[model samples]
Target: MGSIKPAKSLLYLAISMVIGGTLLNVNELAYLAVFPLILLAMGLFVEPPSGIKIERIVEEKTYIPGDEVTIRVKVMIERGMGMVLLRQPLPPEVELVKGNNAWSLFKGPRKLEKELTFSIKVPRRGLYTLPPAELYIEPLLKLGKPGTAFLGNPVTITVLPLIKPPRRVRTTNTRSQIPIPLTSYSLTGPISTDFKEIRDYRPGDPVKFINWKATARRGNVLVNEYEREGKKTVMFYVDARPTMSVGTFQENPLEHAVSLVASLAYYFLRRGYNVGLYIVGRGELMMPSTGNRQLYAMVKKLMEVEVLSSANEDFKDAMRKSERIIIQYTPLIIVVSNLLQANELREAFRLLMKHYKGRVPSIVFDLFPYSMFSGKKVELVRLRKIAIERELKAISHVVHWDIRKTEISAVLAKTIRMVR
Candidate 1:
C-alpha cells in the first residue's frame, strides 16, 4: 500500500476537531461534519508528480590526466507537485562540493520546477560511468519521507593516456639511409648473387677469379664478379630495466624510449631494413618481422612491457639466435639502453664483435640524466653519474643523451658525433 499522510492530516484534523467539537457542543453539528470531510478529502486527493526530465553534459568526451574537466547535470520538472526532491548520483571516484551528496529539493504549488548543476574534477585516466538521478515526491501529508524513482540514461567519459615529453631520452645508434633500388644480390657465403656463372675468360677478364675448365673450352680465362646486397638488417635491443626510471609518476622515461623505438622501427621498416626489437624484460620477446603487422606487435608489446632490474637468460639466448640467423647478413647492430653494468656491456659487445670478426660495428645508447644531476646541487651524485657515462663511452661506441636538456630529436641529431 502507498504511504499515508497520517501526521499532516492528523494535525489539521485535530485543530478542526477542537473547533468542531466546541461548536458541536453548542449544537453546531454542520461545521463539525464539514471539518472532518475536508481533512479526509485532502488525504485522499493528493496526486503524485510525474513528467520529470534529467540530462547530463560533459565538457569533453576525451581527457588526459591532470586536465580540468567539468560535468553539468540539468534536471527539469514538467509537472508541478506538493514537494519534490531530486537526488543526482555521481560516479564514486568523483568528489562533490564540500563532501555533500548531489541532491536538490523543490517545494511549491503545482507546476513548480527547477534545474541544478554539479561539476567535478576528473581524477585519473580511465573510462567513467555516470549514474542516473533519483526523483522523489510526496503529496499532502508528510507522515513519511518522499517516494523515489530513478531516471536518466547512463553516460560515459573516456580519459585518454597521458602524453608528455621525456626529461631524459635516449636515441638509438643506427643511422639509416635509403638504399638504391638495384637488384641487390647476397654478397657473403653461398648466396645467389655472390656466385656468377663460370664463363670463358675474355681478353679483359681478371686473372684472380678465372675458371680453368671454362677457360679450356673457350681457350680464355673467365672472371667472377661478386654482387653486393643492398639490404641491411638492423636489430634494436631495448634495455628496459627498473634502475632506469627517469621521470615522475604518470610520466615515465621508458615511454620516451618506447616512442623512439616505435618511430625508428617505422623508419627502418619503411627503408626496407628488416627491423626487429628485443625488449630485455619478463616474457617479452618481439622477434624480427616486417610491415604494419610487425609494427603493431612492437607497439603493443611496448604498451604493456614492465621494467625489471634483470631480464631472463632466455632473452640473451634469443639475441644469440638472431645473431646466428643474420651472421653473414647483418652489418649493423643497435642496442638502446641505459648502460649500467660494465661486464654486461663488455660481454654483449664481445659476442657481436666475435660474429663480425671485428668488422661489424655496434652502437650502445646510454639513456640517463647526466646533465641535471651534474651541477653543484648534488656534486657527488653528478660525479658518479659522469664517471659511469664516461666508463660506458670508453668501453663501447656509446651515445650519451641528457633527456632533461633536449628532446629525442635533438639527441638523435647529435648521435653522428659519437660515431665520428
Candidate 2:
C-alpha cells in the first residue's frame, strides 16, 4: 500500500477554511473543510501497483576496452495504474556514454508497457557485472508516496585488452626472413652438413663440399648446395612479482610489461618463429608453442595477470627450469622486468649466462618504475634511481624503457636496433 502526503491543494483549502471561519461566518466556510478531508482520504487509501514484468537485454557480452555497449530494458504492466519510475544503476567499471538511465512514465488506460535504453563505455579490461534495475510506483492523483520494486536481472561482461597492430621491424639477419609460403617445420638457415641439391661448381666453391658421385656421372665438377630455412624460436619471460605493481591502476609497471610481452610475441610469431611464454608471478604459466594459436594463448594468460601483495619464488624457479630448454634450442630469450632488486637481477643474469654462455641472443628489458617516483622526496627519488641504474648496469645486455615517457612501438623499435 502506498502512503499519503498532504498535497498543496489540500493545504490551500485548509488555510482558506481557517480564515473564513474566523473572520467571516463560520457556517458558510464549514463546507470547504469537507473538500480537503475527502482528498486526504482518497490519497491515504490508494493501492500500490503490482503485476509488472521487467526484461533486460544487452547488445554484447564481450568487448575490448573503450567499446560501447547498449542495454535495453522493457517493462510491461498487467494493469495500468498511476505513475511509474524506472532506474538502472551502472557498474563502476563503465561510464554512461549516452542516453538517460532513469525513466518516468505515466501509466494511462491506453499504455501498458515502457522501454528504456542506454549506452555505456567500458574504459578498462576485466570482468564486470551490471546491477539490477529498480522500479518505483507513485499513488494516483500525485498525492501519495512512491513504492519501489527491483526490475532487471544482472549481466556480466568480459572486457579484453585493446590490441593494436605492432610496427614492422627489419631483422638484422637476412636469414631470419619469412618464406613466402610457410612450412610445418624447417631449418632456419643453410648448413653445409644438411645438403639439398648439386649444382655446377663455381670458381670459389670449396673442395670439401663437392660431390664426387655427381662429378663422376656428369664429368663436370658439381658442388653440394643447401637451402636456408627461415625458422627461429623465441621465449619471453614476464616478471609478475609484487614489486611490479608499483603505480596507479591507469598506468602500472605490470600492465606495461604485459603489453610489451604481448606485442613481441605477436611480432615474432608473424615472422614464423616458435614463441613460448613463461609468466613469473604467483604461479608459473607456460605456453610453449608457435603460430597464431600460441599467440592467443599468451594473450589470454597475460590478460589474467594481477598484482600480488606478497612475492613468490616463481621467477627464480622459472629461470632455472628454462635453462635446459634455452641451451638446447639456443632460442632468443627476452626477460622483461622492473629489476627492482639487485640480488634478483644478478641471479637471473647469472643463470642465463651459465647455461647459454652468450650463445643465445638474450635481452633484458628493464621496465623503469618512473611513475612510482611521482610525489616522492628528491633525495629518496635520487637514491632509488641510482639503485635501479646500478642493478640494470650489472646485467650484460639490458634495455631500459619508461612506459610513461614513450609508447610501446618505440620500445620495440629500440629492441630491433639492438638486435641488428
- Which number leads on lDDT? 2
After superposing candidate 1, which stretches have Cα over 4 Å from the reference?
1-231, 309-318, 321-331, 370-378, 416-420
**Tens digits of per-residue lDDT for model 2, 360-406:** 35677777666446655634654665677666664545777777777
Worst ten in a row by lDDT for model 2: 176-185
Report the Cα lDDT for residue 5, model 1.
Answer: 48
lDDT of 1 by residue, 1-420 (tens): 344546455657766767776866854643565666665555566555567777878776556545655666666666534566666666777556433335645544555445455566555445667778777777545434457888888887765444332232345634333121222212353433456466555676557777766767776666665555446555677767765565543445565566566666666566566666777655455556567787667666665565776655433554665665446455455666665556666666556655543434556666665454445755564556567667766545666655666677765544433322
In angstroms, give how far residue 76 of model 2 lies from its true place: 3.5
At residue 288, give the lDDT of candidate 2. Answer: 54
lDDT score for residue 417 of model 1: 36
Best by TM-score: 2
Q: Against the hidden true structure, what lDDT does model 1 obtain?
A: 0.58
What ranges in model 2 sit over 4 Å off? 1-47, 55-57, 61-63, 66-70, 139-147, 171-231, 321-330, 352-360, 371-396, 417-420
Q: Candidate 1, 342: how far from true, in Å? A: 1.7
TM-score of 1: 0.54
* lDDT (C-alpha) at residue 385 in model 1: 55
